[model samples]
Target: MNCEEATKLLDGYLDGELDPITSQQIEQHLRDCRT
Candidate 1:
């Protein structure tokens, strides 16, 4: 996911509301992304 999408999902992710696939995507993005 891009920064915008990831930003929007942050709350859900922190609250454990996102599905595994989405969580994985976010995690991957965070790992590979550089500002």
Candidate 2:
């Protein structure tokens, strides 16, 4: 996913509302992105 989607999912992640796949996507994005 893009930064926009990962960024948007941040809240849901913190709130424990997102599914495993979505949360993993965001985690992967953060791991690979540095800007």
List the global CA lDDT of all models: 0.95, 0.90
Can you give the TM-score per candidate against the true fold? 0.92, 0.84
User: Candidate 1 at residue 15, lDDT?
Assistant: 96
Clashing pairs in 2: none
lDDT of 2 by residue, 1-35 (tens): 88888888899998989999998998899999988
Model 2 lDDT, residue 16, Cα: 88
What lDDT does candidate 1 reach at residue 35?
62
lDDT of 1 by residue, 3-32 (tens): 999999999999999999999999998999
Count of steric clashes across candidates, in order: 0, 0
**What's the lDDT for candidate 2?**
0.90
TM-score top scorer: 1
